[model samples]
Target: MTASTSTVARTATPRGSILKQRVRWGLDHALPRTVMSYAARKGDLPGRLIVESGNVETADLVDLFDAARADGPLHRGRFSFTTASQVTVKEILTSPDFRTGIVRAGGPLAGLREWADIDILGPLSAPSLLVTEPPDHTRYRKLVTRVFTVRAVEQLRGRTEQIANDLLDKLDPSSPVDLVENYCARLPLTVITEILGVEASDQERVLTFGTAAAPSLDLGLSWHTFVGVEAALQDFDAWLTDHMDHLRAHPGDNLMSKLVAATEDGVGLNDAELKATAGLVLAAGFETTVNLLGNAIALFDKHPDQLARLRAEPGLWSNAVDEVLRIDPPVLLTGRMAVRDTTVAGMRVPEGAIVSTLLAGANRDPEVFTDPNAFDVARPNAAEHMSFSAGRHYCLGASLARMEGEVGLRVLYDRFPGLALQPGAERRPTRILRGYDKLPARLS
Candidate 1:
């Protein structure tokens, strides 16, 4: 995994016909076509469309994102009235304000005050952050910024590397090993637990809840999932409360203790806020990282040259991670509600309307990027990828996630230089999170 081993600098070209075939396959079978159809037909100017139709036949959010990327960034077209209703009914997404306008109009949090269904504590309520804006976002983010600092993340590099190595050690080199479950999924779960200061014994339980929380948005708040999330929240809340009490009495090195101490200083989070923040960190921390790793592995398998180049030039791991995020971001579309009538990329959106910030679309904008379809780790502006998002709602755990990816990839290559994907392994059946349920790889 040393720098000298990387083949990134080598200019090995891909076959034209194969490339064309892949592109054709993508366009013919991709998800963006459906999304574009929906957007063109159902979306109305100056009003938010609450997409809730065609769930059975339409592609999920993840599929829509894949399609959106293909459509390039910022598709502008007029929506006919007839098309708008039919298409809108099929979309099952909540719009978060694209910028600050919605927050200024009272924001989604104001709406939450009135509805019990907006379980700020439930898994389905993960969309709460998308609905928040500006000053409130700024205040909450600043309060927790220290927890995700680069230095703090650097401290976990050793742990992340160890987790990857330990997982690698457990694999039977002679047999196919599912890299997703064994390595990718396991690493993030371990790292997040370490950050939260959750005891080793409870890590698996917490991770189960965290994974369940990942899809609450698309799944919608059904009675079954809602009750499950509620029970999980109660468990977590009680654990955090007890942990906070212990930290108050005996301050320790973990994040919980630091948050507890901050509370004592009068900048402390209330019970509700604390639960919400902790839940966010837990879900975002592991779930997103898992997908990043899984997507990267899939990309490498599909583009062996890139994988070889990365192995040769380990420093490229950093850039490669950025490219992976750009191509297959873990979290596809983030939501925002508009506060008043406004124009985004020229379309007039009314107040109280929801705007979906298509991060996948923005990343693949031909106007902003050259050969947007190609995976180029050395692209001069690779770091500009919006996979970590932007503005006030930018991910607090970005640095830590990057560190984990870098170290995890480095360790994997270093430990097994001949690692290759298993002949057959089921890709995860998920549309929102672009990840493999089982990625079988072998070390020869």
Candidate 2:
């Protein structure tokens, strides 16, 4: 049972595994889609947004948000209650009546949670900070919050600068290069691996695992895609077992090692807790930041005026990062399930009702951001966006990501002021997460 002995990369996934994934999709995704699509037909923004196929464009999103806004801040949908108002989003996210989780307890699809079980740890599952509440969430956050605090990120800034510099230094930017492969992905990859005590040799393996498994964040994935993701999760789960065992025996001065040894009130994280925490940290540590970097690069290429402003006042780099997150966030939306009957924004949200908040829509709420559709790096209140989610579940790596985004973008531009972006940038396929998968560019 201990895949603790297996290598990171295994042989081809068996044919039966595809069948297994198909069944998972049927229960986990298709079932949800049926509800969502039904809701979509009856005027549900969140439902339509997820099930609608084809290339997602900014224009299409604007229409959805406008419709949701017209329908008012809080309205009931078959899948969940949907909201487009920024204020409602803030309220729903910060409310005590709501709780952290994807599936609502005793809700129509609650059975799917039990059916969704897998051997590998998923970020959205239990024992992870993402899904647990209060005491457990508080305890888990306490253990790692110190390392990601603003002050802690400030301490890590020097090393981050060096990491960014080294990544860009190796870029042969002479001809066309995929910035994602060359620079954007590597900077965060190096920094996160160093924190986790993983060696250079294992970073790419980690990246592959994360890349393949990233779609696990989105629902309603095609059977084939879901199968591939499961394979990666299985491989990653096996690798983590071996790595945690290694770290325990030969502890290093890194988060994973510290996690292995540190105890909370005389009790340390159990194996499930340890793997879930470590794996979530490992994937999250790099994945979104990779999106942030790539998204920023593409945005800058499109808005040289913003770059000009940043160049004029390099001090604005930090706020500029916020601007990028606001306009083109790395994550699109998040849902919160109600634990008790509570009225939000004058609407009665009963127990077990799921509140779907369109974070990207909230960011673009005209009432909150002036010229909401326009990309303005110096929009005085640019940092007000809820791209990081709000309250307890706010991204633990927010400070780290902000620092990385600022450092990565600033270093790349300063190093190559004449950087020219090539045509044909493509966004990632996952609906919940947003960012570029490939960005072709040239640095002169």
Off by over 4 Å in 2: 1-21, 41-43, 104-126
lDDT of 2: 0.77
Residues 1-444 of candidate 2 have per-residue lDDT tens digits of: 210000011112232444555655686667777888787788676788776622475435878877878878886776578787999999998888987654323544444433443222234222477766787788888776744568856777899889888887777868888898878889998888887888889998999998998877777667787678768877887787788788888998776777777776887777767777777788777788998998889888889999999999999999999999998888877888887899988888988777778888899999999999998888899999989999888888888899889888888899999998889888788777778788988898
* lDDT computed for candidate 1: 0.56
**Mind giving the per-residue lDDT tens digits that candidate 1 earns over 308-415?**
887677778898888888877776555444445655433456664444555655566565678876887767777766777666667888988888888887788778
What is the C-alpha RMSD, rounded to one decimal, of candidate 2? 4.7
Compare the candidates by TM-score and give the number of the best one: 2
Residue 435 alpha-carbon offset, candidate 1, angstroms: 1.5
Worst 10 residues of 2 by lDDT: 2-11
Each prediction's whole-model lDDT (CA): 0.56, 0.77
Q: What C-alpha lDDT, on a 0 to 100 scale, does residue 37 get in candidate 2?
A: 78
Residue pairs clashing, model 2: none
